[model samples]
Target: MAKRLLFIFMVFILGDIYFFQAFTTVFHTPFLHNAYWCIDLSLLIGVATLIFFQRQGKDIQRQAGDLITFFLIVFIPKLVALPILLTEDLLRMARGFPPRNIYLSEFVLICAALIVLVIAFGLTRGRHYYRVRKEILSFPDLPDAFDGFKITQISDIHSGSLSDVDGVRKGIALANAQNSDLLLFTGDLVNNKAAEMEAWISDFTLLKAPFGKFSVLGNHDYGDYTRWDNAELKASNLDRLKEIHQEMGFKLLLNESIKIQNKGASIALIGVENWGKGGFHQYGDLGKATSALPAESFKILMSHDPSHWDRVTLTHDQHVHLTLAGHTHGMQFGIELFGFKWSPIQYFYEQWAGLYQKQGKYLYVNRGFGYHGLKGRIGVWPEITVITLKKSVS
Candidate 1:
């Protein structure tokens, strides 16, 4: 752990040294230089302090979140400037002389400034900038009576991280405005403790849909990240979280399936506990969830992590036409514009954000309904997904 911290410190120092060149070249004022170094040094100290507190197991959730947000605000712009300055240095070395471009430093500064503006907005307003993403999934086997059924999905609420009650109220109001036939929450209702959701219970209860609201657990819902006095305490916290779901009018599905029927036609909604790839816990049982369902049932599944779709759901004997998920949170950062989407989380989970289809199965991974560790969202804003189910005609 010490070695890892040292390595991280060295990397930050190196990056600071490399990025300082652009600042020096672009700004002639000594005061500006002093301010820049002061911020950097303070961030370095904060990082060290945060690590120490974390190692000591102190409750530094808010501090850690703030430090991460500040560090990224400082680090990302400098990171953007690195390649620009490096390109100029490479040209100088290749020619064995000073680079001809006099405006390169200024250009790098401008780019960094723009990035700072974006990051600032993300920290201030983007955390609650809920975007409603709509998708119309057509399935040949869909029940005709259920065609045009609208489903609203919001995942990774992380109520513990939410500070702006009005922001959350607006987001919930927006979800209600969608008038989705069914509402589904895909987990992470709190960061760690069930008590974190106490304040927002009323706000969430406002989310309405004609077909009723349902949910499934995510990895964070298990209280796995925090220390408990005993096994029973941790278990009790989880039990309370489940009750909280009910208090908010959500029918929490552990590893079960229920039918949503209309006009004598029905579709099966199967929900499982958090089942993720890599080191995440595997509490979900796909077989148990779908065990009694007919093979021909048009199934819509609610699983927390998108990886479950790739690792388990796709090949399961029971065919699930659509799966809704939200664990990745698109890393709460990334670029998604012009019909192209990319987030660092994609490297870990193939179906990180938005909609993905494979072998006739559809999965929509919500970017998340709330922010967590970083306390803000970058390009990947919080999402409320509305999916309309349509029957495909031959």
Candidate 2:
């Protein structure tokens, strides 16, 4: 199983690089005008899927051919559309119609395509956010201690989504408006460097939580994806990110738990390093973090990936009453309106958005505070989670 999993991971990584290059190459080219406007995302996804099947020891040559065909279909026109999207400088270089308007109208078309790309990219990114939120659990077993607790959770802000400083400020402002008793961030504060959030630290500082503000690292926080070329610099990046969290008045939780007390009522909250059960980050020691808590205590686990619920929380002997996670962004495409919610990412994830309760355990996966791929949100807007925990009153 592990070997198969690794192979699939390799296929996914390779397929991603191949398709991304194919698309970028087309986008930067001046030719390949034979593409169409009636394109759908399924073509590319199908190709990606074929790669998965090939890795699973199904068929490779057929899948590879399909991928090539899909590549040709998307690659050519994307390049064809690029010049049309650009200004006359590069526009004249391509063979578009009506000279300047060719470029202008094509540019408009590209912008429209961008809107679709945002939806698609956001949807893809949103896959990780699929966590069935926990039910407002009632711990009447005699906690008489902490009731009516409100914990605010947000994740995957991917701060790079903003163009200027206020964009980051605005995202924080929205999250702060929730007035949560305990405000928690699950990780991915900045897309790259710790200093990238330098200008926005004060904004995070504006978040007011009576109990306290706490956070953990996400996959991006470790600086693992870059050309680090050195272990020291990468380690420093993670360390500085921790410092930034502390500067924002957040108690950085790393493979550890802290008991928060209110009105003489105390509950344990634990957070760990980035843990992804999927093809992502390392799983934090859920058992080790919770080892210090009383076996009977009402515990809330704060690992970044909701998949941890399935991996550890659900079947564990130490009943974790609630788990808060937010790596998935709800694929940034689903519609949640007027009592209805749906997204394409749901097919890949069992709990894509909202609250979910299974086998006496709960996980709340926040949709996140900012966009990742494109700056726009369609059906799934940037989220502000306001969870009020009250007695079941049952």
Evaluated with TM-score, which candidate comes out highest?
1
After best superposition, candidate 2 residue 337: deviation in angstroms? 3.3
- The sequence of per-residue lDDT tens digits that candidate 2 reaches over residues 211-232 is 8999988877887545565889
Residue 371, candidate 2: alpha-carbon lDDT: 56
lDDT of 2 at 254: 89
Reference-based TM-score of each model? 0.93, 0.67
Off by over 4 Å in 2: 1-137
Those runs of model 1 whose alpha carbons end farther than 4 Å from true positions after fitting are: 1-15, 28-35, 99-102
